[model samples]
Target: MVDILILLPIISIMIGLYFITLGLWELREGVNRHQYIKYMFTGLFLLFILTPLVWMMVNVLL
Candidate 1:
């Protein structure tokens, strides 16, 4: 459980970056910027919001 807590953020960051990159690539295409914004927001939410939230939960629970 603790191990998962430690790894969660790292994994989320990697996946989040991947999603953000995909979003950015689509943004460069300039066809459906609004659609890709969802990807970017998802990434940001996972990377920033979820990561710290998990860490805080882990710390409090532990």
Candidate 2:
């Protein structure tokens, strides 16, 4: 349980980075504007919101 908790943030960070990269690629191509926006939003949310939320949860649990 503790190991998983500790790993969550790292996973989120990687996923967030992947999404942001996709978003940037989409932006560069100037195609599928809605998808690009959604991707960017998801990436920011994961990096800024979810990562800290999980970090706080881990701190509380430990």
Scored by lDDT, the top model is 2
| lDDT tens readout by residue for model 1, 1-62 | 78987888789889999989989998999899886999899999989999898788878877
- What CA RMSD would you report for each candidate? 1.3, 0.6
Candidates' TM-scores?
0.83, 0.96
What is the lDDT, from 0 to 100, of the residue 13 in candidate 2?
97
Output the number of the TM-score-best candidate: 2
- Relative to the true structure, candidate 2 reaches a TM of 0.96
User: Which RMSD does model 2 reach against the true structure?
Assistant: 0.6
Per-residue error (Å), model 2, residue 13? 0.6
Give the lDDT of residue 35 in candidate 2.
92
Candidate 2 lDDT tens digits, 1-62: 88999999999999999999999999999979999999999999999999999999999999
